[model samples]
Target: MYSRSNNGARSHRWTATLVMGQVLLWSCAAEAEKLPHNLQIHGFASQSWLMSSDNNVFGKSSSGSGSFDFRELGLNASMRPLPRLQFSAQMLSRWAGKGSEGNIRLDYGFIDYTVFSGETSQFGIRLGRMKNPLGFYNDTRDVPFTRPSILLPQSIYFDRTRKLALAADGVHLYGERRSEMGDISFQAGVARPLVRGDEAEAAVFGQLVQGHLAPEMSYIGRVNYELDGGRIRFAASATQLNMSYSPGEGSIHFVPVIFSAQYNAERWSLTSEYAFRNLQYKNFGAMPDMDISGESYYFQGVYRLTPEWEAIARYDVLYMDSNDRQGRKWAASGTGDGRHAHNRFAKDITVGLRWNITPEFMLRAEYHHVNGTGWLSTLDNPNPADMSQRWDLFSILGSFRF
Candidate 1:
């Protein structure tokens, strides 16, 4: 049967990823020994198997055995040529359904110059391609060890718009101040977001259009406060991300603001984030000028069962149109079929377990009960009609880092 063949293929892919991951890890270890003390090399690899009861996630998860289409590989190096100057770069390959097909690409490459350094305070400038400081997790979202969960809360960190949020090309200024009271850190940047991809085009135009999406000038910044060495953390971030559709077409503009807070303890942690998004479309003749506001938020809790084991639970929500939370208004407006109303919003409940087998190896499993397909990748699910409003997903992942 076709289902059997598909399942077999997925199994093979999963096995292949595991073998590749081991090879890469060994390779990194070998190279690390040859590198100089000033030059440090590190990398991580993760592969995930996902299955859904009703909808697709990270590939054809709705099918018999789920999909083995989720994986991440990263290699990074940092060198300090001088005490005040450092160079860092990372190359990443990510496979997450049809939106990201595991292409090797530059994640970030930057030169950092420290203008001032004190016992408790420092200021620096970074030039070149740098990660956007959006929230607590954006800077290191791709690394399994750095993430609190297998997936960062999708409401605030939607994979659908990942390229735009991942990193930007330009200059950033950063400062840090630490005292007995707490620590304050900030990073502000002027850059151009990445906007060339099927997912990016679909997100901006509601569908892939005839023309291509081009990056334009954008600004991003984040400020954070930590108390008692991260016992408590809070942050505020904002972005003005802009892009233009070339070949004599319209333009797209996005402005989003986010607020984040977290509490950490020896045994447990609590975290929350909220975001407000504004979007506009213009100049495309038949596309009609439009303006929309969206909202997203999530609350999560993590408990450490042991030094090497942890459990996590979270609730995340996203709305395409703040005014139409239920999506009935949009359904009635007839822009599309009424059945697709579920696309306007999504509510997700997730729970997961993580086990650190070793300092460099980890295994994780998670489940998600979701209502709505608001964040589904258009490239993965080209036919919205076949999508189910409610779905159940289960996933397992193995990760290694050196």
Candidate 2:
């Protein structure tokens, strides 16, 4: 838990950083406008307000005035000095509940060199801090303009442990092939995963511990296929993330595999994804080694009322322990009181509206009817017994970009 004084200090720092970043981004954009087409710069800012009927999210959202503690700001630039080589980087500041403190940090920076290029195929390599191509959205989830709704399907995204999966320092090999049948692209990487924040530790152990989670060598890969120029698409991605706890806590390994599919039409689109997560914990103090498997999936549909307006609906589900979906076994084993059953699973129904007021500005509103608290952040809602089995969340956001 964080003290009120600490929260205040963090908020102040975030405000100062936001102002400085805005000024810098605008100045760079103004200068880039006069530069060659090889150089590009962009930035975005979003502010969100959320209110919940039960279980706090992104702050004390269940209370009066809800929470204005959610926001995101980002700036990025890319330069292609040569036809086959490019450099790109982004800086991001995000504030969300107690887990993220709105600190500005390097989101990604990388150098890309293409080894070969032809009319039908290309091969390349990238080295530096790069985003893990875990799913269709992980690479671009930070930008509000690219997200389908205010909040992504938590079942697969797991914002609680985002830092561990966000980006890594590594090298990636990529290739693409285009033919009359369709287009196929693949990317694979080996790197040291990022585990700086305490969020990943708290998520695995149920609370913040005395030790830290250290980064370890990991691997990630993805394969994507597009037919009829993206009218239909399919993707499969997986990653193995390794970490160790200091002071002799233990070793932890997380492996997750996802399958995704999407269909696009003139006015409507459909998307779905399924994920299986495997977690292993070994050599803990006196506790026996453990292995747990989790499952998640969601189906979503979007309809474009107009070029500037859209409507979205989705059903998302999550199970913390596939073997004990109802939590009867875990609850009976003395993990907690009977109320803990609801913590094992979650089912969410969501509806949202998006208004692209202009190419550079947008507004969004969404509502969620959720059952179970399986995905709630422990840092945000400390008292598990006080959590409600059913809850409601309403959110609104405004975003501007250049």
lDDT for position 188 in model 1: 98
Model 2 ranges with Cα > 4 A deviation: 1-5, 28-33, 336-339
Error of 2 at 313 (Å): 0.3
* Tens digits of per-residue lDDT for model 2, 142-260: 99999999999999998888888789999999999999999999999999998866677667776677677898899999999999999999999999999998889699999999999
Question: Which digits, one per residue and each the tens of the lDDT, describe model 1 over residues 361-400?
Answer: 9999999999998888766776776788999989999998
Question: Which residue pairs in candidate 2 collide?
Answer: none
All candidates: TM-score: 0.93, 0.96
Candidate 1, residue 170: CA error in Å? 0.7
Off by over 4 Å in 1: 1-26, 31-34, 337-339
Poorest 10 consecutive residues by lDDT, candidate 2: 1-10
